[model samples]
Target chain A: MLMMGAVGLAIARIRDLFAVSMLSGIFSLIGAAAYVVLDAVDVAFTEAAVGAGISTVLMLGTLALTTRKEKLGGGKSKSTTAFLVVAVTGAVLVYGTFDMPRYGDKIAAIHHHVVPRYIEKSGEEVGMPNIVTSVLASYRSFDTLGEVFVIFTAATGVLAILGRARRRREDEEADEGGSDTKGAAS
Target chain B: MMHRKVVLRVVSKFLIPPILLFALYVQFHGDFGPGGGFQAGVIFGSGFILYAILFGVETVKRVLPPWSTRLLLVVGVLTYGLTGVAGLILGGNYLDYNVLAHDPLHGQHYGILIVELGVGITVAASMITIFNVFAGQSGGD
Candidate 1:
């Protein structure tokens, strides 16, 4: 948790977008480690892969297309209100967590829910040893389908935006190869 | 360029295959492990992303063009939707795996496997597509 705070602080203070992105990735990786400590391995796996690996690469790609540093003193900043809002929200969130059940509280409200049924019957019903997989893929398959559709939609949106920009660039420059795209790394 | 990138290129080449192999293992073995389509897809996608970063976008694009990645993403979504439809056609409720096989237990297994596979396909394709498009642009927006 302290490591996460350190990374977040570093990211907040950094004016270089590249370093900020790197710090954010480190923050995510630490968060993933916390998930593992909490025994939420599946979530940890997703967090590490998506947050650390994929997000870092995507951020670098975005940086490749944009300026490396944050522009200072852009317009009249509303620092006071922003600070107030952030403080209030953070206070509220921290206060809310205080009321949550302690880790693995035996008689926690969440423990009394359908989790028991999922644990006991998932093996026989779904015939899977990993209850999380059976729960996610079979008992609640519709939800997974919805998640997939969401990703599909997001990709479509990105494609639509990029396609137009590429076309406009081509029209202006009429460069067939667009070889400049590979010029940096190569 | 090649001289400067020789170590990066050689190391990634050696690492990429195993990375992809682990992703497939996660995708197929989720029922017994702590990973699934979501995790596996990102891992798989990152392997390619690593290759693209070190080897240049053009080399990766030659194998996985933007248009094909788009089609793969669409196909992934369809596979999941159609699996649900299959459950309906088999006289069960939508997404009901009881009718997928003779044995209801095995049916659930098959249903989960195929559904996760659908998720894996779409997710991996989407990641690749987004990365290629974003990095493929020649200049800043």
Candidate 2:
């Protein structure tokens, strides 16, 4: 967490977009390490892969298309408003954590719920030793299906936007070809 | 593109196969271990992305074209949905693995395996597709 904070600070202070992107990737790697400490291996794996790896690559790609250096100053009022929003959100989140059960409490509301049943019966019912797999793949299969569809939609949306841009460029080239022929005839 | 780095090129060539092997291991071993379709898919996709970075997108495209990626995406989803449909056809609830095989335990095993494979395929294809599209756009290719 301290490492994440330092990386975040570095990212905020950096004016070079490329450096900021690299710092954010470092932040994600730190966050994934934190997740591993919390025993959420699956979430950690995803954070490492998607946040640190894929997102870093994507951000670098965007940086290549845009400027490497960030523009100086968006005005004091904008900064003040952003600070205010962050402060308020952070306060609300901290406040909300007060009502939560203490970490690793066996008798917590969540642990008393369907978790016990899942823990006890998943092996017999789903036949998977890894209860997480049984829960995610069988017990909550519909939700996983929905998640797959979401990914599919997102990929389709990206393809549509990028592919259309390429097609438009091709059309412009075709139009320019006609103009080139007319100029030669003249 | 790091094409000039001979060490990177050779090492990545050596690493890609093992990365892919680990992905398949995670995909199939989720029932017993700490991984599943999602992580496996990401690992698989990362291998391809690594290949693209080291070798160039043109070479990767030759190995796995855009059309095949699109097809795999559809096939993955279809495989998942059809597995559910198969459950229904066998006189069980939608997505219920009980009827997938004569024995309930074996059915659950089969069902989870098949659906996990589906998830892995879709995820890997989607990641590759998105990467290709983004790379192509930025490269203006």
Candidate 3:
């Protein structure tokens, strides 16, 4: 927990974009560690890859194209409404946690019913030891498909942005030489 | 930028392959472990992101062209969608492995392999695509 707070502070305080990105990666790894400690190995793996790995690259890439330092002095005043809303939401969540299930409680709804069957029989049924895998690939295959599409959509969006820019660059270069040569020849 | 260190480059060269290999392992070993398509995809994507980080976007683009990545994105979706479609044609519900082959176990093996491959491809490409957008932004320093 201390490490997580420290990582958050490092991210907020660092002026360098690269350093900020690396710090965010550290924050993500911390989250992954938390998930692992919670016994959610699948979630831990996802957080490690997405949070620490891909997210860092994406953020750094954005930094490469933009200013590293934030605009120091030009932003509008903070909105009190936004602050109050966020505070209220956080408080509500904290309050709601009083009703939450304690960790490792055998009576928790999440640990019982069809899930337990999957956990116990996945090894024999799916011929695999990973209950998470069996549940995701076999019991909830549709969600897996949806996730793949989500990635596909994101990839397409990026390609469209880059493609438009490349085309503009080519057009500019073509006109640059043509206009100069025509002016000279004429 | 030129004055910046090349430490990322050397590190990426070594890190990218292992990251990818680990992704593959997670994908295939999931049935016997605690991972599957989503985890594998993210791990695979991270490897490409590492390449982008170390070598820079230009080098990463050269290695995996935007067009190829786009193709992969489409292919991954198609592979998964088609597997489900195959099950439907075989007189079963969507993604039902029982109809994929004479033996249910054999069909499951085939289905899992195909779906995991799809997940890996989509993940690797999407991650790189996100990185491309970030790198394409207007200011590095």
Candidate 4:
């Protein structure tokens, strides 16, 4: 947590976009470590792969397409509004946490419900030793399918937007060549 | 950019196969271990991305062309949906794994394996496709 906070601070202070991206990657790696310590190995694996690996590459790709340095600007109103939003959201979340059970409480509301059944019968029903996999792939297969569709949609959206730009450029170049040929022929 | 570095190239050449092998391991071993389609796919994609970085985008594209990547992306999703459809056709509810085999337990195993494979293929293809698009854009610009 301290490492994450330090990385966050470094990111905020860094004006160089490349450095900031690298720091964020470090931040995610630290977060992944934290998740592992919390015993959520699946979450940690995802955080490490998506957060530190693909995201870092994507950010660097974005930086390549754009600029390495962040634009320097001081917008007092924007900063004030952002502060107000963050403060209100944090306050609401903190208030909500007051009604929540403490971490690792065996008698927590979640543990009392379907979790016990899932833990006990997942092996018999789903026949998987890894309860998480059984729960995700069997009992909660629908949700996983939805998640896959969401990824597919997101990838499609990205391809459509980026591919269109490239194709448009090609079409314009072709148009220019056609006009040049017409002029020469005429 | 690092294509000129022979040391980097040689090391990556050595590294890429193992990375891909690990990805397959993770994909197949997820039911008993700490990985699944998502992580496996990311690992698989990263191997290719590493190859692209060490070699060149054009080289990687030639190996796994954009059109094929796009096709695989669709195929992965289709594979998932078809697995569910097979369940329905076999007199089970949507995505119900029991009917996937004669024995319910074996069916569950087969269902999970097939779906996870679908997930792995889609994820790997999607990541590679996204990377290719982004890299191509940067190069074009």
Candidate 5:
């Protein structure tokens, strides 16, 4: 956790987008390790795969197509307002955590609610050893279904925008795409 | 230039199959483990993305054409929605697994497996398609 926090700080302070992206991947790997410590292996698996693996590759792919260094701003910065907003939001969020149950508190409301029924009866009812899968697939599947469509919708949006990019690339290829590809390859 | 890098090509060739196989294992074995469709899908999609990185996008396009990714995306959703419809047609509530088999227990098993597979398919297709969109254009947009 401390390493993750240090990586986060480095990412925030870095001006180079390429280095920042790399640090974020490191941060995610550390976060995945933390999740494993917390016994959320499924979440850890996801964080490690999506954050450390695919997103890092995609970010590098993007960096290949763009400037590595961030362009310095010429206008006056809004540091005061941004700092104030961050401080206020951070304080309020910390305050909000005060009312929450202590970590792993047995008396937590969530443990009292539908959890017991799932824990006690899920084996007999669903006949599955992995309650998480049973919950995600069979019990609250409507919710998971919605989540899948949400991903599908996001993909649709990306395709629509990038398809235009492809067309523009094709048109440019008619002119000087050869030179561009040659430059990138070398 | 990338083709000259023989180590990347050889290593990725060695690694890709195992990664893809692990994704399938995660998808099917989630009923007894700490993995499920989402994680499995990302792993599987990244397998191809790794191929693209090592071999380039054109090679990957030959393997997974754009139309096929789009079709897979739709087919995933269709499989999921149709599973629910199957339950309803079998005289249960929407997404209810009780009527899917001879007993409710086995029904839940089949229901979970099928639905997780649907999620896996859609997610894998979505990730691959999205990555291709971002990486396909060599020229910056």
Candidate 6:
């Protein structure tokens, strides 16, 4: 929670894209660690790698093509409105938390049902100790396929961005050559 | 050329290979432990990140040419998608591992391995390529 607060502060205050990227990566890693502590290793692993590694690189790459520093002290002020909204949201969240389960209650609703079946039978059937692996690769393989699609989509986006610039450069080069030819002909 | 940071330079040289190897182990050993293709990919990607951080993006690019990165990225996606298609052709459902080999267990093993490999390759290349793009844009600016 403290780290989360620090991350929010850093994201809000930092201006340098690289610094912001590093901080956000830190924030993501922390989230992964939090997930691990919650006994969700698979989710933690995904969160750590995708959130911290790839996302940071993508955001930084985009920032590199654009402005590193945002216009400070020139944007319109929304402090009062933002504060009121935040206050209301915080109050609601806190209210909701009062009805939530206590940490690490073994009999929690989440611990019931088919998960136990997976945990018990996965090793014998799949010969894999990690039930998460069996679940991800065998049972929920389609979801993993979807995840691959998501990655491909992101890569395509990056290629499109880079490709646009290359095309623009080629157009400019063609224009320059056309003018040179016209000059020679004239 | 700027004077290099002694610690980061030496550390990266020794650290990058081990990190990559570890990533492979994680990918392969995922069936037994707490890792898989995605985690392994990031760990492998981190090797390139270390390389880029220590030696500049130019050196990293030279080592891993952009065309190869793009190729690997495509190949990874193809590898994953094709494994599923292969399963389908074998008369099972899409990405059904039971159809991969004569024996269902063996088929599952083969299918999982190939799919994970594809994932790892895509992950590592995409990560490095993303870094390269940013570095290029930043340098140009």
Top candidate by lDDT? 4
Candidate 4, A91-144: lDDT as tens digits: 999999999999888888878878989989988988888888888888888998
Candidate 2 structure quality by residue, lDDT tens digits, A19-81? 998888888989999999998887898788878888888888778767899899889998899
Which pairs of residues clash in candidate 4, taking residues 3 or more apart in a chain or in different chains?
none
Q: TM-score each candidate.
A: 0.92, 0.95, 0.83, 0.95, 0.92, 0.85
After superposing candidate 4 on the true structure, give the runs of residues whose Cα lies further than 4 Å from its correct spot.
Answer: A180-186, B1-3
Candidate 3 residue spans exceeding 4 A from truth: A9-18, A73-81, A169-186, B1-16, B52-63, B132-141
Q: What CAPRI-style quality would you assign to candidate 3?
A: medium
Stretches of candidate 6 exceeding 4 Å from the true structure: A14-18, A45-65, A74-77, A97-100, A173-186, B139-141
lDDT of 6 by residue, A1-186 (tens): 589788979898887777888888889999999898888888898798778877787777677667787766744458667878999999999999898888887787787877888888766666677888888888788898888878877876877887467668778899999999999999
TM-score computed on alpha carbons, candidate 2: 0.95
DockQ of each: 0.75, 0.82, 0.55, 0.84, 0.71, 0.56
Interface RMSD of 6: 2.1
Model 1 clash pairs are none
Interface RMSD score of candidate 2: 1.0
lDDT of 6: 0.82
Model 1 over residues A1-186: C-alpha lDDT tens digits? 899998888987788999999988899999999999989999998998999999888898888887888988644457667878999999999999999998788999987789999999998899999999999998888888888989999988998899677888767675545556557559
> Interface root-mean-square deviation for each candidate?
1.3, 1.0, 2.5, 0.7, 1.4, 2.1
Candidate 5 Cα outliers beyond 4 Å, as residue runs = A73-77, A168-186, B139-141
Fnat for the candidates in order: 0.91, 0.78, 0.69, 0.77, 0.85, 0.57
